[model samples]
Target chain A: MTRALLIGNSHVGPYLNALKHAEGEVALDLDCIAAFGDGLERYTIEDGVFCGNILDPKVTGRKGKGPFPGSEVRAVLKDYDVVLLTGLRFSIFQVIRVFRDLGLVTMDSSRDYATAAENGVTLVSEALLHRLIAERLSGSLMMQIARDIRAATDAPILVLAQPRPTRQVLVEGTRFETFCNAEERGEGDFVSKTYERLAQELCAGIAAHYVPQPPGTIDGGMFTDTSYMMGTLRPPFWKKNGRPVDFRHGNARYGARMLKHVARELETL
Target chain B: MKNPYSDLPPKAFWKTGVVQTDKVHWPELFVPKFTISANSAVATAGSCFAQRIRQALADEEMPILDVEPAPAAVEGDLAREFGYGLHSARYGNIYTPRQLLELLQDMQKDAVHKALIWERDGRYVDMLRPNVEPDGCASVKEVLELRKQHLARLRELFETVDVFVFTLGLTEAWIHAPTGRCLPVAPGVIAGEYDPKLYRFHNFTHSELLKDLKAIRVLLRDIRKGVKIILTTSPVPITATASGDHALNASTYTKSTLRSVAGEMAMKFKDVDYFPGYEIVTTWARENPAYEANQRSIRPEVVAHVMAVFLDAYGLRKTGAADQAEPAKIHDDAEYLEGHDDDLVCEEILIEALQK
Candidate 1:
């Protein structure tokens, strides 16, 4: 059995929740520790052990009943064979904002994109766009955590992207209008693939592997399917009823699907 | 009889003015015909030296009108690499007066030079400013589309600029044989095949330079009445000349002709003035020359001194550096000149490589 430890922000909920009910001789045994917002920023790793707020009950909102509950025991890096770090702040929505801000158009020949110049936009070269994306990812929290983990242990580290926003993001009145427009123009796949490549390259800078979201779980070109977005796992102490639609997180099914993909990727590695 | 020479100031004689004077403190090198205050809506274009001028003015908190600006997201060297923040508009290094004249004319017209698009390895480049898009456009259609937008912005730039600074760069240029339109660089150097039958080299004569400058002035006034013009000859010499003359002789001829024409224009027009940038780098600094070891790129300190004199003469020098917007950190000369990342982005420099 492969011992995997996942540590990150609130995005860790689904993955840890899926691991709770996981049964019948699974090849992967998973453990998780999570903190929301800047809660993780307070923690530091030293001598192969994470220090500060190992499991702050007040900060994580887990109280005690969640799969990964509050504990005074600090997590050690060398305890696991493989380490997974999610919530490194990779978001396709933010990538879309960059494209819109720069008025950048890709030269993906397979899809017929409208000439950017007609709309007073500039067509950036692929090499240049790659540099811009890499620059954007360089200072990400994921990169820093990966470096920290690499310094502490020789264990293989995998950086998982935050689940892509739901396909419903393309609907009218949403803030992702430019993203929706790009989809209408058939540029979605190219942008997503380009982001994936740059994100992977970012991981490689620290000798870590970037595990992308499972292709099966994604709908449209760069968004998680609605089926996976609903019924998302949240902290147990959270509001029991009438929470707004969670468009950015995935349900336990997605976590199970993604977990399987991660296992398969690890076997090859 | 007391001759004109006897009564003249120390600057009139070379011995007192140049050889004996300290290089750091040359007296009254440039007396502006008109003052350019910090509020002046300045626009800059021309050769590589003009970029230095743009940077200096931007540093002093001058209102440099940039119509086609790099979006805030694109910062520093990358912004400049894509031809932003290099000039008032993205027309990179207008090496010849004819090219500048043609660009101004194009700004007024609602047209695209479709024939100017050249293809290499399935990618297209706008031959006019080939280096602006380092990777060529995806198609011939994309090139034309971009050029159309660029020209529109140029029109806006011309209409709004209060002061326009142009630096004369070169006398030699390649022209389309049929249309007589000048290209910024040789065809094959950046992109496209060099068809001798289609393009030919032409060196602008003294008379031709004067004529082109005349037409440019007329057009500027026609576009925006009473707009002031500042003309300076680039101190940096041509990297290579297509004329059969030796490189040194060719460079001298190019600089001299441009200097003469600029002087003539300033003499004729009250609104036009000549800044002795060429003289500052070449003549005054006889012992400690302004040029780097390459003899092409000017030293950063020299550039700063030139701008100091310019801004000081016009009473436009900023009083306090504290209030100024954090200017883009200017790179030193060595890195800018040594690598392919020429901050000046001189297309003419590419010619030296082709000569080998």
Candidate 2:
């Protein structure tokens, strides 16, 4: 059996919920350690332990709910066959927004960008944009965590994909307007493919591998299908008094789909 | 019975004017015909040393105009590497008066020819301003499109500048054989192959440069009425010369011609003024040796001293920042060299490799 340790922010919720009802062959045993929002990024590996105040919540609050509670996470990293790192605030929406604001048009893009030139916007080449995005990601907390883990153990690292936001965001239009504009302008596929390609390259820099989001769960080129987003986890910060669902994460069924993909990836490795 | 020389001030004599002048009182070195205040809409473009002037002005919170600014995500060293915030726009290192004149003409026409795109290692670069994108563009179409947007921003820049500061760097340049348009760097130095059949090495004469300056003035006033011009000759020498002369003789000839042309233009036009940055760095000082060991780059302390004199003459020094007027104190050679490394982004230095 493969023993895997998963570390991330609230995106770990779906994986935990899926493992509860997982049955049959039991080819993999998974353990999870997570925090709310960017809190997980605060931990530093010290004296063979991932130490931070945020990790204390998972140790004390929900003891018997999950396999291998957060408290033992730091000491057991080397014992696992593989470590999966996911969701330190990286999002496809952020990438789309920066590219749109910079007045970027890919080589394959058919969007009319003549207006961008009239607004005194500078056009960046795809090669330059790729480098800028990589540098931008290099400074993120997820990469920092990856480097910290690599220093601590020799276990193979697998970087998991964050769930794409739901398609409802385009209709709501309260946030991530750039994503909507990109869809209207037909730049959605180029951005999605570019993000996946660069993300794979970044993982390769540390001799790790990247596991992309399950293709079955994605609707348009840039969004999650609505069927996977029902009752997705919402932290207190995102939960309004009467809101019915979290528009950003995926549910247990989506996690089961992602798990199948991850298992097949591990088999090849 | 007093002679004409009897009433002359101490500044009239070389011994008192240069030998005895201290840093604090050195602001009198060059009297300004016009002053730049906090409100002046300043635009800068020139050789690498001109970046020092922009840095000093920006450090003091002066109102310098940047027509093409980097996005908020690019900051610190990354912005400099990408060639943003280097000048009013990213027209990198306008080394010759002819180059500057050509840039202004291109802005007027609002076009950059597709021929300016050159490929290096399967990646295309703007032959006009190659260093702005360190990693070359993916395609020729991309280069032309970016240049189109750059020309539009430059048009906006020309219509709005109040004071234009330009430093004269070199008289030697490589030119396209068919068209006289000067290439910023030698072919193959940054990108493209150097073909003698298609290109020629030209060392501009004093007459040609002076004529270009005249045309530059007319263009500036035509775009914006009463735009003031401050011209300075860069003290930094050319990294390499395509001229047959020895490098030392080539450097001297280039500086002498530039200095003479700048001085003559200042005298001929009312709106044009010359600042003696070349005289300041090349002239001997008792305690401060200006150039670093490389004998090309000027020390940071000297650059600071030169700017102090410039800002004081224009009454643009930050209030209560009197310490900026004093010479930078250096306690040891190691300490001095520690922080004084040349960080100017110069593409001309690439020619040094060809000689090796």
Candidate 3:
């Protein structure tokens, strides 16, 4: 029996079913170890151990640091034949900070910038900003994590570059407001370029496969929390009142597409 | 020497309600003396109609220098939405020479000035936008300086170009409120918040268009001396109009003005010619067939035919016809596959053909 470990952020949700479909088509035994949360918390994976809150409707409630410890990552990975590491969405704060540091954004006042920094927005030297952020959570880090898991499990490591979401869905009033704000500040291209560079760098040393999602394919089910309000909103679009939601996460369709590619890659593996 | 028109019937002869055969005397129309095919590097730009010209030449395997960037990804509508690759082939229309010149000048200037301001969230942000400026120009000096640099770049591009094609797209454009500079599209269409005070519409009259065309011709001559120019009018209707005229009438006026200017320029300039792309698509192709159900854009087959006619006019032929040929495999994978067409009544020959 061959097992495949899957590591990714919220975007990996849709691909779960796709991975299953791929396994059947390719006739490979596969196990997905998907971790989800805010910040580095999503990296925790263990059965029954909570790791971060589930923002998705498919899953319920907040999860603690998991049933499995970070040290147990290698042990759990040991049973898999191959490991796949997907990409992560940038934290909202990270997006805001990057733009603010770059001088691409001026605060409403100097006080706002200082306030944002004091509010746990990591302040680093201007020269080290991009490099520091890149070193910490870039796709390369994910690749290294996959490599470590592979070493422990005696499985081949196959890192998958994060598939870009076809659409950029913005939800107002949610914590995701920072991303939309950054996008408005003309940082959309900057963010995209950074992600592209990260993907390229991740694929450099590793035998990884890059799969791009078809452009403009996002529909309503993906960002279920954000609604198009008729009026009263600044942008006239805001998050609906209810459970906190992460509209930035990819829907099942995105996962389905990635799974197809993953399944095809596994056949050769 | 053989009479080039010897095969043609007399003009007095009537057939199909025409005076004589519409057959062209290829040798007379395209004299060998002027049929030099050099390894020229031509740059094509104009309104959207210019795209058709490029595609037509490309379909015939004719070499033309295309400076546009390749797409970043394969799938989806990015290529179309962003006006790159095949999307440009279908919808690139340059409305005026001034706008085209301005774009070239800006590209040239952008090469040196790499910084660009991106507007996000009601703020301006500095971002790195790649610059591929034309040679020998650092920054735009003035409108006249831009014109001079544009001419220089055109000369450089034409030195290696055997034929230069430009399609005039529109006569109406929005001018910058402060600078009085004409923009490619209205400000609000693509970018920038709509400010009525900051923008005003300028509809160029026939005389104004002619003056611009003359200036462009002089610029072309100053550079390449005798670079051949071909002009066409875009047939696509305007998405919206500030003229307060009905959209149909606006389209007619725009197309008519462009076509008339093109015709006049063709008559006046020795190296200038006009291709009837608008008439070909709107009248010839439109009258022939219905468009595909899903897409209202011109049918692929019609585009192909238009391109073929274009190639024939330029005395160019497709190289490696077999290489360009598409797959002809029939779907006869299995007996089960054949059962799907069970309702069809087939003759013995047809059945034999299918079996074969």
lDDT for every model? Answer: 0.77, 0.78, 0.46
Q: Could you tell me every candidate's TM-score relative to the true structure?
A: 0.82, 0.92, 0.46
> Judged by DockQ cut-offs, is candidate 3 incorrect, acceptable, medium or high?
incorrect
| Candidate 2, B-chain TM | 0.93
Q: Candidate 1 on B1-356: residue-level lDDT in tens?
A: 88868888888778887777766546677778887777889999999889989988898789999987876667887878878899998888898899999988887785678788888898888888997888777667666656776887888898988899999999999998877799989879998878999899999999999999999999999999989999999999888878999999999999999999999999999999999888888874366566765677776666777777778778877743322324233556655455443357777788766765
**Candidate 3 per-residue lDDT over residues B1-356, each given as its tens digit:** 66775567444234421323332211122222234253444446675445655656655555666433322221233333323343222113355666555444443453322222224344332111101110112222211222332234333464555566787777778776665556666543333445689778888888888887877676566556767777777655554556888867876788898889888998887788877656556652143442333122344445555555555555575553322434322324463343332211111112223332
- For model 2, the docking class works out as medium
* Model 3 score (lDDT): 0.46
Each model's DockQ?
Answer: 0.25, 0.50, 0.02
Name the better of 1 and 3 by DockQ.
Answer: 1
Residue-level lDDT for B125 in candidate 1: 85
**Best model per lDDT:** 2
Better TM-score candidate (2, 3): 2
Q: What is the TM-score of chain B in candidate 3?
A: 0.64
* Chain A TM-score of prediction number 1: 0.82
